[model samples]
Target: MAVKTNCNINGIDYYRLRVTIGKDRKGKDVIKNFYGTSKTDAENQKDGWMKNKLLGINHISIRDSLSMAMFNWVWDVLKVSGIKVTSFERYEGIYRNYVEESSLGFMILEDIQRVNVQRCYNKLHEQGKSYSQIKNLHKVINMFFKYAVIEGYLLRNPCTGIKLDVYKKEEDVGEIDLFIEDEGTVETFTDEEIPVLLEGIKNKKLKIMVKFALGTGLRQGEILALKKTDIKNMVVQVTKTLSFAKLYDDADNYSYETIVTRPKTKKSIRKVPIPTELKKDLAELNKIRIEEKLKLGELYQDNDLLFPSETGTYIDSRNLLRSWKRAFEGIDVPYKKFHALRHTFATQLIKNGAQLITVSRLLGHASIKTTEIYAHVTESTKADDVQSLNSLFK
Candidate 1:
């Protein structure tokens, strides 16, 4: 229960003080003072305080409260709770962007109201943010408010009732290309440009990497992280990824690190068969590494890294990107991304009349639907097969 009290101010009666019974940090009842002008104002404020207390809102002011910095607090909570690294990364990105651009940065957590949030959203939209981005922003905002409500920051979440026209402004951008019928997105590499592109890369290491990617349908990270132990018979086991490390302040050069992480999905951690033609190439690569190891002697610690640097150190992703760009100078290809090699592998598999299931396995796709993108590319191949079978029947 809360009580309102009045005192004389400049010879006039005014509700200058309000006292509310609330739990302190120890959950014991404590009296809190709220400043107000009128008796009704003081009583209303007291009622709201009691309601908030029942809801378990934090008694501390937003500026002083631990929940004030939504980004930091949420990340700490999620990290301690053992959330997945990839998901936490995305959440962190969203929160970072919001704090940097939204009015939420200027406001204390206690001052966050529905109108304030609405204004923030409008300003963001005016700044030319896409509808999808705005929706994501709203999602993070809602998540912050939801956590606040659950943690007893407020009696009710002010963000609950507001709705936005997120999807209604529909404009049809014509039918998408049906080349890759099952894949929601299209990725096509004009085969005519393959030879011209292959002739450009003079570096044997970079060439081996590019050719291996084209043959195996492995991601850049997965391919670069390949170790000598990963190869057995004609099978390659994907168990780790070489990712570009985040740029560190005061560092003159970027670095790469390998993490023994599973692929994006269960299917992504699959064994892919090496083509018979590349067996000799693989053997040569081993021989070169062995000779290099002997020459380096004690200097070489045997990191077992398949794609080591010129000095037998770990190969950085930035180096790979630079090498790939130099290779692109010789070939005029429509595709500019490094991952296009994986796409090329998928396209070739479909064109060679391999089943979707086999293609899915080779590509380490989690779903058959993911591999079905080749179904569109295989239309001509499938039709040619059908025609040949009909000729046999005749």
Candidate 2:
């Protein structure tokens, strides 16, 4: 049972509930304090503490553990803070991927020292986790403890002044002819592959999507969420991105629910210039869409998406991937991510003597550093540069 002490501090009312957490080495009653503005709030807090103790909750003996603290803070605070839906989902994903499955979740908040958290990170590294993966886990855990400390759930955060390092394993030296360096180069499709990809895509609408991806570096969700109004006066405005709640693909049916939200970052809301050739193609696409809408008559469902299904509703992202796979069926080029098209767009501009800042702006990159990742030096381009050395040798 917790004892409530009512006090008046300089005309302000305050209530404190002190609960017996455990016995110390000296046989003293180890206590935990929860303060509130009202007596009922103090009692409620005490009652909740008692309930946790009775229910054998591991994380709530005195203070919340990593699991409870993270979840409670997220659901109680982050959800109500009006964060973007996509960012909130990503934050939740970190908790699910890192804390939910780890041993650190059940440990007492005070008992978890810096070394204990470090070992957890080391275990993740040994389990072949990437640096980015471990970093995300660290981020969530770090923020969780910070929240706990701020809310008086814990005295100090264990994650304070800590660093994570993931050790990468060496692959077999003779297994492959050439090793792919992680950050040494950016991967993009060759000029020849573009034609094959376009030709392989039978659907005219899907073909237009691939062309747009190559022409502009819009993200998958951004492109899927585009509307007829988004394109105007030889320019495409990227304003919002589509958020998918869940996706289910069955043998007979496929479906998804989407929530349209603002673009991921501030830079993602910029406008991209549509080339002259692409403008003409888009004009023709509009004509085709007008003809289709007339044929469907009252049965057509118009969501105003630039690229919609025959029924005029937003296209399912998964179904769009099926179409993407069909487009690459006969292509001889190696498999690359769909995002590689964005890289291709940037690389073509750089190869044709376009400025770095120009490409950065066109891609809606927040910083020029991000755009640099898409800029790669090809072997052929290097060879051309090496030829310039011939004059110096003479």
Candidate 3:
């Protein structure tokens, strides 16, 4: 009979079972330990082991080491967890890039400590990975350990106490000026730059896309996923987003496919009101689309997309971005990423005295904190108001 005993390690309570196998060559008993979160769990583990031994089957626990556990967890568990395809790819990428080849990954599950996880993050930071990247990596690793702990594979999550902030480095102000800025600093076209941008774009389709993005504050993916039926009564319903993901076949061959998935979050499914001016523009665009369909006469592949490729399939995001850059040719205004159009929409709203909460709902942000990035625009507006007061005093 296997002996089961209550045990505590690192403040975690569990049960340990000691089993005696056949004696060694020297007539000494061979002992093995199986651990679990409770006595019944330990007994079940021991029973399974005994059954495997009786059948002459070699059974290795996934919790034996970090790499083995992570591989199984990612492929066997997380892959089928109903997450978006892009999200699965991101987690797999982080494991391949940061964890699988690292020293901590090779460590035994029991030997992994908080310091080991912290060291991994420190190394990533030292390698010039951005704070956001490290933070995302931490999220994946933490979830991995948390799952282990819940399954009794680990006594506690080694990632629980790790501090990511300590690994963050202060940005150099000079470097910021030289390089393109991050989302922390929202960039948008000025009122003067808008007309210049519109007139400069050579492709009529790309021009309409830009105008729609500016007016509605929809993400590039959301705009690309739009169907003609998604708009009704001068409102656009943002229910889905288009994504391009690299996927692997059973034979390990990789290919890219365009997928239409639900909006990023529940809030992203809300409707956005279309401006009166953009409504007229869309009606005109619809007429042009009808003309193109008739001209193509069975050659066109109609997907009913509001904005589709020349043949009516999904537009490749890369091609759109490339065309966008070329659209700025010989133009006076500096080029910004397509996302800047959405940023500009939010900023313009804030400047026009729209309430922050209202703006947050309009933009479909999951949290108000995300919308608060544009609060600085309000501060700048306040400074202008102060200047007007100074003029009045004069």
Candidate 4:
């Protein structure tokens, strides 16, 4: 009978299958070991290899290494129990976009060399993927390999010790007259630029939404899911998040659905206090909504959402992007994302001397280290510093 043993290497667990294949020509019993991410895969590989050995057609069990492709990774994710629905969906999107479609993703787990992985990373960088996004890709890749190593799918993780650049663009953005380093870092609009941005946005609901994001730094889904009941005494309780998900019909037609889920993390459920101005804004907005409801009467769809689409449906991110772009039109400043508002808020607080721990707590981050990225100043601040040289020149 074939038996399995549990072992861990480099902190990753694996199952080893062992079997005796009779005596060799040297009069010694030949034992073979096959490894797998799962006992079933290991056992099957051992049996298959043993059968092929008798026919003098067996290789080094090279075929035992599974190909970590999009479809296969997805099945692995589904089989792994207790993953949050939102996390699973995010992982699915990452795989389909970066791995399953990339050249590196098509190779067998054993065959993916460091050079191949490096090439893929370079390609993503060349495609203008943000440093944070590339980091996210790397994180997903690391996760896949960690599971692969634990299950013994591969003898080792290919992502290990790959020499790569992080935030290499810093050199190009490093030139500055101020004490700050010269080079592009995290993007954000200056305090002055924010007013211009808010003023240019034509959509009233979106303007308030942007204000709420700047004030609280809440994620798009969290902002979209906000309700009247979630707020009290200027404190907003983040309870749920809503994201767009697609549904298929019997005939294979696709329609979009809103997948409402819990907050992203345990820390994400923290309460955020709003400024007094924002509280007044909310009150005024609520009165407007009440009037709207009374006017629309039977035509109104009342979900009690703080911000919803005109017809009271979930706001689509793509449509939100269009609104974001329109808000920047006729503005002389360089374009930044709607997300930059959150960044702007963080940087402004940092400039005014907010502690990193305080920022981390307000941002609902799991760790203080995650909030460290917001400590850097923007180029606009440096430009303002240069303007002060006029006084020194005199």
Q: Which candidate wins on TM-score?
A: 3
- Which prediction has more favorable lDDT, 2 or 4? 2
Of the pair 1 and 4, which is ahead by TM-score?
4
RMSD in angstroms, all models? Answer: 12.1, 12.3, 10.8, 12.5
Which candidate achieves the best lDDT against the true structure? Answer: 3
The better candidate by TM-score, 2 or 3, is 3
lDDT for each residue of candidate 4 in 317-378, tens digit (9 for 90 to 100): 78998888887789866788776777777777787788878887887766665566676453
Model 3 earns a TM-score of 0.76
What is the lDDT of every predicted structure here? 0.62, 0.69, 0.77, 0.67
TM-score between model 4 and native? 0.68
79: Cα error in model 3, Å: 1.1
Where does candidate 1 stray beyond 4 Å? 1-68, 83-89, 104-146, 154-188, 247-260, 354-358, 366-394
lDDT of 2 by residue, 1-394 (tens): 6535485432334575667877755678866555445667666766786686598552433344455556556666666678776666667767767875456764445667887788788888888776656766777678777777777777888887677533433321111101111122356888888887777778888888778888887877888899999988878999988768533231112343688888766877899987777876687678768887898999999788898888788878878878877777777866666777877888888888888899878877666766655443543566887899999978
The estimated TM-scores of all candidates read 0.62, 0.73, 0.76, 0.68
What's the CA RMSD of model 3 in angstroms?
10.8
Better of 1 and 4 by lDDT: 4
Ten-residue segment with the worst summed lDDT in candidate 2?
172-181
